[model samples]
Target: MKKHNFSAGPSILPQEVFEKSAQAILDFNGSGLSILEISHRSKDFVAVMDEARALVLELMGLTGKGYHAIFLGGGASLEFARVPYNLLKEGGKAAYLDTGTWAAAAIKEAKFFGQTEVIASSKADNYSYIPKGYTIPADADYFHYTSNNTIFGTQMQQFPDTDVPLVCDMSSDIFSRQLDFSKFGIIYAGAQKNMGPAGATLLVIKEELLGKTGRAIPSMLDYKQHIDKESMYNTPPVFAVYTSYLTLQWLKNNGGIAAAEAKNNAKAELLYNEIDRNPLFVGTAKTEDRSKMNVCFLLKDEAHTEQFDKLWKAAGISGLPGHRSVGGYRASIYNAMPIESVQVLVDAMQELEKSIQ
Candidate 1:
């Protein structure tokens, strides 16, 4: 059976990316060596790295705007520490907006470096909504927030207007929609979502933001060092970076972020509309703060759980179960998820209602 994948991370990618990556694994760039065996220092791989970094900036409309894009080895979790290490000066404060598990994790990391202030949070409400009307400390080194919450099903529809260097962890929603990319001092995301497989994280930093932390940073965690070396600081994640390059090429060919946003919005609408209209279901997140990338909802009656689960599974829907923290179902409609797949989930929901009635 053809499966409609909805796993949150290391998730679905464009079909062409899979095909091309597989071919490269067998014979990379027409060379006898697989992409896996090829040296990261090779001319071919260097070109791949160069183009991937450039494409990140180009696709986000940040090219030549004093922004540098680098693909790093650790997941965004590593960045939770590196971000404050490089940006937060000793005894200086950093501001954060807590909306989900990952955001809280970042705050935890930031606290180690200096004073970390949570300007706003929705944790008291089980993180079902985005907090607003919070004040960012102007004296803080930077302001950080997660753009989308994959586990909780909430996304920031609008960003806060702040002069404090804006830092964002966009792991779940990067490249899914359009935004003013220039406003952010830093933006980072794990490659598993819209980019590629796991093993790589993309970080786009404004050049001027680096080298100001009065404390000495280990070379591995220094953004300036990586940028100076042109993202070839270490061996790098060869396969992950190349596959991410292929995905970005795919995005550029398909009319870039604007086009992807259109598809993403359509997919979310299809699923959320069914969740709202169907008497058998109820959405978990606040109506106004619902994520376009991850739509979470629950059956109205727990008695129908077994039936609903079977219906979606029978319809070839995989990864339909929500995170353990938020039980029920979560349909992650990322940039690459087709509207047709979302319809399958909606149909399953409708089927459950009819059968139960």
Candidate 2:
């Protein structure tokens, strides 16, 4: 039976992407060698890296003028340190918009490299909304924002335009939307959520923005270093890159970023509408700031929480449990999930309502 999976990360991918990738794993491009066996320097692997980078550029509407698309290791956690290290010079500061756990973590990492000014934070309301009306320091190296808060289910509906380079952690919603790439200087995201599986990060940086801090950053941490080496100085994550390639190709063939954004909005609408209509449920995030990718809601009667979960699990719906820190369910509708899968969850909610508590 095809089960509905709503886990936040390492979430659902297009079935076609998985099947094609599985075939390639057995015999990559008819080389008579499993994809796992190929060396990173091989011509076949180089093509995969190039295509993955190209697809990212194409989908994000980057015309290769200023942006350098790169696939790097160490995920967004590593970028937390690297972002400030590469940008913040001696006596310079970077502004961070603290929304939730990941944004708070980014601030913690940025502090190690240089001063990080917390210009705006949503902590007053337990991170239920995105902060607003804070002054960005004019002398700061860059302004950092987390585009989507996966844990808290809030998102920045609109970004503030500034002269300083705009840095963003788009981990949960990179290819799922459309935006003007020129407005962003650096954008990084861990691939597990929307791009593909984990083990790698995709960074789109403005080429001109590098070498400004004037510090000898370690080779790996430096964006310029990866750009110069073509993301192949060391053996890259072969399978992850290939899977990302498949996912990007799938995105391109299936109406690109614009279509994905529409589908994502629809999914969020379907779930949120049900949450509002049902008196027994309450949404966690505010309406204007709720994330299209992660929809968090709670049952009004806490007594029925366990019963609500048990019913869904028995019906082949899994991973609807909310994060421990936040009680309730989080339905993470990423790029690969179809509207039909969302309908199943909505239908399950209706069925649960029809049945006795």
Candidate 3:
């Protein structure tokens, strides 16, 4: 049975990407050296890094717009601190929207760097809905938010437009949709989710936004240093960056972000429609805020949980379990997940409902 992958992070990637990466591991570009053993300073690997950075800018519509893309060794969690370290100035206040777990974590890290204020939050409701109608402080040095909440299954439908510099951690939803990249001063994402395997983080920073923080940033955490060195200031994550490059190539071949969003919406709809229709199931997030990438749901009747679990398992499903903190089910329908796999999941849900009825 072919397994349907729905893992949250280090998730599914295009089959073609996997095949190409495997071949490159053995002998990269006919150079007779494994991608693993290849030198980071090599001309061949430099080409890969350059292409990956260029592709990220192109896909986000930031090409030649004073935006520099860099891949780093740390994940998005590290970026939570790095963002404030490089942007939140001393004695200046930073505003954040607390939509879910990651957003809360970002707020926690920002406090260490400066005066951090949570302008809005939906944690009171277990983060089922995205907060709205809250005022962002005009005097804030910058505003930070997570574009998608993987654990809570909520995504901000639209970004807040504020004079304060906008920074985002798009770890779970980057490249999953089309966006006006010009609106954000900075955007960072972990490559594991929609981009590629774990190990590298993608950062798209506006050139003019650096040096305003007035703090002595560590070498690795400084965006200007990474940009000046062309993402080669230190030994980069070679394997992860290469895989991400392949994935970006795949996205470009598949018609870029717009095409991915169409498929992602379709897959989310297929499963969410079932969750709403089936009397045995119900979605976790509010209808309007439901995440297209991570769809969290639960069985309506707790007694039937085991039956539903076995139903999906028997149908070759994997990673349907929710985060441990939230005991439910989360179906992560990323860019690489096909609509057919979603239909299979929907069919399994329908079959289980029928059996119970």
Encode model 3's per-residue lDDT on 45-156: one tens digit a residue: 9999999999999999999999999999889999999999998888899999999899999999988988999988898899999999999899998899999999999998
lDDT of 1: 0.94
TM per candidate: 0.99, 0.98, 0.99
Q: What are the per-residue Cα lDDT tens digits for candidate 1 across 1-357?
A: 999999887799999999999999999999899999999999999999999999999999999899999999899999999999999987899999999999999999999999999989999999999998899998999999999999999999999888999999999999999999999999999999989999999999999998888999999999999999998889899999999999999999999999999999888888888988999999999999999999999888899999888888999988988999999888888888989999988898899889978
Q: Rank the candidates by lDDT, best first.
A: 1, 3, 2
TM-score, candidate number 2 = 0.98
Give per-residue CA lDDT, model 2, range 113-194, as digits (tens).
Answer: 8888999899888799998788888888999999999888998888897898899999998888888878998999999999
What are the lDDT scores of the predictions, listed in order?
Answer: 0.94, 0.88, 0.92
Can you rank all candidates by TM-score, best first?
A: 1, 3, 2
lDDT computed for candidate 3: 0.92
Best by lDDT: 1
| Residue 124 in candidate 2, Cα distance off native in Å | 3.0
Clash number for each model: 0, 0, 0
Candidate 3 to truth, TM: 0.99
